[model samples]
Target: MTSAPPLAPSFDAARALRQARETFDIEAAAVAGLKNRLTDAFSRSVQLMLEVRGRVVVMGMGKSGHIGRKIAATLASTGTPAMFVHPGEASHGDLGMIQVNDVVVAISNSGESGEITVLLPVLKRQGVPLIAITGGLQSTLARHATEVLDGGVDKEACPLNLAPTASTTAQLALGDALAVALLDARGFKAEDFARSHPGGALGRKLLTHVSDVMRSGEDVPRVAPDTAFGDMMREMSAKGGITAVVDAHQQVLGVFTDGDLRRLIENGIDLRTKCAKDVMHLRPRSIRPDALAVDAAELMEEHRITCVLVVESDGSLVGMVHIGDLMRAKVI
Candidate 1:
């Protein structure tokens, strides 16, 4: 008989799952440890970011460097001006980019990397303030920095305990925590973000207003309540808008638009039986004259129509603004 096939090696899936849970717990502990440790150093970092007259330069090496870049970007977007600098690049003459007025955030787990350590003497000589994020409080980097943020973890999540995975994740979380703390301390608002990001959608959403972008005065298509359907049709045509505002005593009575006309015709209703009160949409959705134009645009979109009523403090029809008006002015 042929020799039996060799049996496969025994593997327990439950054991593998237990190992994964152990690694997860290690990382969780690393993060949970941070909540109780925030002290004066955190406050000082916030104060430094607030008082910084120039950009914050973030420096780190290898994996820490990657985390540094993300931290810098988060800081910049949240009100603090910041940028990333590689430790290796700084050693090769990029150190000149730092100024005495600027703050330097140097990250290192060992706190003894040659590339980062080499810049210390020069930074000290130039009077640049240094902040360190490190695992070991007694490491050279911590000793040299004006502020030391503890990024310590009990152990790594790697199976062999040799990789930087869990340590780097912890450090990244700590950096983000610092940035968000600074952001709140500065009372940074959406308006401030809009100023920094004029091209971004958030800026557009928060900043663009109707008054700044709406068409006004005689250009608005309008007619008296008693005006004939023929005259209202002419007004709509002349204004090239979907609707015309009807007024009496300078107060808006109703709105006449193409949709209204279609509904009347489709039902075979008496065209003459319908006057402004009978044919026009009564008490149509209206917007404050002083409200943001974007609000008006939103109203139009919400109703799946292209027209809006612009009302005054006394509910009078001061004018009418259309989607075209808002779009042409780029308010929409």
Candidate 2:
């Protein structure tokens, strides 16, 4: 058999990177263009959302549906109650999700998506306000909307100029802008965001209290200020690292950590005769039980300590938290 010629490399890494950059540049420009187009329509959408007694129901088809779902999540997380419904599914009974008090945000690049346009009359008859995000202001979707926000793009990022690229980017940016406006108007704070996302790391950092992760009750290593150093060592070892040295009233006087023990040993102090009060570090770093876990972590990091005592406002030790506890809680 005759030998076949070696095939040339089919992949061009440089060209691929150049094409990706081009796509990003096009979309960036599209989003940037939306800044100058911000008008009364944008304000009207925000006002409608702010006044909504019901959820913001977002509807779109194809790629717009994907973007709409993200927009809905952003709105819901940022303090606005919102949800996305596929327009095709809405016609098949999902329309029931829309209530008269809800504001409908219908997205269609051409404003002529059959799946979305067909529901316009039903939505209007139900007395629901419709906000259209479309490239063509004169499109059918825009004509039916109570308010219209132009999401027009000069061109698609696709070389063929057919794919929903730049237009979707504009829609996503506009949706984010609306969500932020609503968030500011509502005075939504980080605590509110943490409440909405209690399962995420940010929630843990912002919402997890010192009491939630502190070692409490008998698990908290503690000793009286006059306790023998040997006895304090036993308590610290039993509890695995540090012990709070408290007074007669169970008020924390100081903390004796493993580092303190090492320092005492280096100084050749008699461990059996020395008292905890003689070797403990006074006014040790501490946090309140109600403080955020992240705050505890920050205190520990700032002092280069491994553990902190959780105390009451009156300096009574209630619990103890270690760096490991914060790490395990994902608050670090």
RMSD of each: 6.3, 3.6
- Give the number of the best model, judged by lDDT: 2
> Candidate 1 lDDT, tens digit per residue, 1-332?
89999997899999889989988898988888877776799789778877989889999998899999999998999888899988898888788789889999998988888899989988989888898988878988988898998888778998888888777888888888888788788888988988788777777667776555555677777777667677677777887544545555667777888877788789888776444555676777778767877788889999887777777778776566678877775665
Kindly list the per-residue Cα lDDT of model 2 for residues 174-281, writing each as its tens digit.
999999999999999999999999999889988899999999999999999888877888999999689998987879999888888788779987777789888888
Displacement of the residue 64 alpha carbon in candidate 2, Å:
0.5
- What ranges in model 2 sit over 4 Å off? 1-9
Q: Each candidate's TM vs. the true structure?
A: 0.77, 0.95
lDDT of 2 at 168: 94
Q: List the residue pairs that clash in candidate 2.
A: none
In lDDT terms, how accurate is model 2?
Answer: 0.93
lDDT of each: 0.80, 0.93
Q: How high a TM-score does candidate 1 get?
A: 0.77
lDDT of 1: 0.80
